[model samples]
Target: MKLSLVIPCYNESANLPLLLDRCMALDSGSDIEVILVDNGSTDKSLEVLSKLLPRYSNCRTVRVETNQGYGFGILSGLRAARGDIMGWTHADMQTDPQDARKGLELFDRHGDGIFVKGRRYGRPIMDVVFTVGMSAFETLLLARSMWDINAQPTMFSRRFFETWQSPPHDFSLDLYAYYQAKIHGLKVHRFPVRFGERAHGVSHWNVNWAAKWKFIRRTVDFSLQLKKSMMVVNI
Candidate 1:
C-alpha cells in the first residue's frame, strides 16, 4: 500500500535538511512519500526544499500561505496526498522518521480498521508528566480512553479519514483524531518510539511552565468545544 507521511512545518528551515535526509534514508518499499507542508514559514524553508527535491524521490511539498494552526497544515497536506494510507508527524524531528515507517508497516498486520501512533519515550520527566496528565484529563472529559494525545506518526486508511466531518485546526487535532478512532470503534494501536531533542531550534510551546500553562488552557478550551459538538451529533 502507498503511504504518505505529512510533516507540518512552521519556520523549520534550520531543521529541514537533516530531517529530509533521515526521511529519505527510510527504505519502506510501500511507495513512501514524505509531504512536507510549509505552514506559512517566513524562513528559507521553501528554498531549501526546492534545492533538496532532486536529492530524494519520495519528497514533495504543500504550501500554506497563511499560518493557521498545526492541524491546518497537516490537513492541507493530507488533502493533497495521493497515497492509499495517510499519516502525519511533526517537523521538529523529535520523533524519528523510521518510527513513521514502522507505523506504516503496522497497517499490513492490523488492516485498515486500526489507527496507529507512537507512544513516546526518552522525553524529560516534566514533559512526560504533562503528557500523562493531559491524556488522563482528556480520557475522562471525553469519555474515551485517550493516551499519548500528542504522539507522532498518527495514521489511518483513506476510508477512516473520509468519515471526518469538521476536524479542528489546532493542536487539538491530535485529540480529535484519537477520540474519533475510539468513537468509531477503530483499534487504537501504539508503538514505542524514542523522543529526542530537536535537531535545530527550540520547541514552540514546550519551553517552560508558563508556556505549558498557556497550551493547557488553549487545549482545554478546544476539548470542551469538541465534546459539545460530539454531543450535538449524538443528539
Candidate 2:
C-alpha cells in the first residue's frame, strides 16, 4: 500500500533536516511520499524545504501564505495525500519517525481500524500539567475515557478523512477528531511511543487558566453537538 507521511510545520527550520532524514528511513515497502505543509513560516523554512526536495524523489512541500492553525496544516496535507495509508507527525522531531515502521506493521496485522495514536513518555512538567488538565476536562465534558488524545505521531487509514467533517482549527482539534471517530464506531488503539522535547523552536501552546476555560467550553460544545447529531439520526 502506498504510504504518506504528513509533517505539519511552523517556523521549524532548525529541525526539518533531521526530521526528513528520519522519515526517509522508514521501511514502508511501498512508494512513500513525505508531504511537508508549511504553516506560514516567516523563517527560511520554505527555502530549506526547496533545497531538500531534490535530494528525495518523493518529498514535496505545500506552502500556505497565511498562518493557519495546526489542524489546518494537517487538513491541507490530508487533502493532498495520494496514499492508501495516511500518517502525520510534528515537524519539531519530538516524536521519532522510526516508530512509523511499527505503526505500519500494526496496520498490516490489524487490517483497518480507526487510528493508531502514540502514547507519549518523558513529557516536561508543563506539558504534564496541561495534558492532565485537558484530559480531565474533556473526560468530564464528553463522558469518555481517553489516553494521550494530544499525542503527535497519529496514523490512520486515508478513508477516515473521506467522511471526516471539518474539525476545529485549534490545538483541541486532536480531541475533536478522536470523539468524532468514536461517534462513528471507529476503533482507536494507543501505542506506547517515545517522546522528546522540541529540538529547536519554542511551543505555541498557552497553559494558563484562560486556556483551560476555553478548552472546557469547546469540549462541552462539541460533545453536545455530537450527541445531538446522533439523536437526530436515530429519530
Candidate 3:
C-alpha cells in the first residue's frame, strides 16, 4: 500500500534542510511519498522548499497562503495526499522522520484499518511530567486513552480518515482523531520512540510559561467543546 506523510512547516526555515535530508535518506521508493507543507511561514521557508524539494523525487510541497492552525496545515496536506495510508509529523524534527515508516509497519501486525501513534520517550523530566498530567487530564475529561495525544507519526488508513466529521482545524485535531478512532472502534496502536530536542529554532508555543498557559487554556476550551459535540452525537 502507498503511504503519504505530511510535515507541516511554520517558519521552520532552518530545520528544513536537515528535516528533508533525514526524510530523503529514507528509502523513497514509489510506495512512499512525503508531503512538505508550507504553513504560511513568514521566513524564507517557501523559497527554501522550492529549491530543496526538487532533490527528492518522492517529495512534494503544499502551500497554504496564510497561517491558520497546525491542524489546518496538516488537513490541507491530507486533503491533497494520494496514498492508501496518510498521516503527519512535525517540522521541528523533535521526532525522527523514520517514525512514519515505523508507524506504517503496524499494518503488518494489525492490518490497514488501524490507527498508530508514537509513545514518546527521552523528554526532559518536566516535559514528561507535563505530558503525563495532560494525558491524565484528557483521559478523565474525555473518557478515553488520551496518552500522547499530540505525538507524531499518527498514521491511519485512508478509509478511516474519510470517516472524519467536522474535524477540528487546530492542534485539537490530534485529540479529534484519537477520540474518533476510539469512538468508531478502530484498533489503536502506540510504539515507543525516542523524542529529541528541536533541530533548530525555538518553539512557537513553548516560548514561555505564558505561552504554555495560553496553549493549555485553548486546549481545555477545545476539549470541552469536543466533549459537548461528542455527547450530542452519542459518540
Clash list (residue pairs), candidate 3? none
What is the TM-score (0 to 1) of candidate 3?
A: 0.96
Q: Candidate 3, residues 156-192: lDDT per residue as tens digits?
A: 9999999898787788898888888998888899999
Q: What local distance difference test score does each model get? A: 0.89, 0.77, 0.88
What TM-score do all the candidates reach, one by one? 0.96, 0.87, 0.96
Evaluate residue 118 in candidate 1 and report its C-alpha lDDT on the 0 to 100 scale. 93
Q: Candidate 1: misplaced stretches above 4 Å?
A: 27-30
As a TM-score, model 1 comes out at 0.96
**Where in model 3 is the C-alpha error above 4 Å?**
none
- Model 3 per-residue lDDT at 88: 93
The reply for model 2, stretches above 4 Å from the true place, is 27-29, 206-235
Better of 1 and 3 by lDDT: 1
Instruction: Point to the candidate with the largest lDDT.
Output: 1
lDDT of 2 at 175: 75
lDDT of 2 by residue, 11-33 (tens): 98988888888877773455678
User: Which consecutive 10 residues in model 1 have the weakest lDDT in total?
Assistant: 22-31
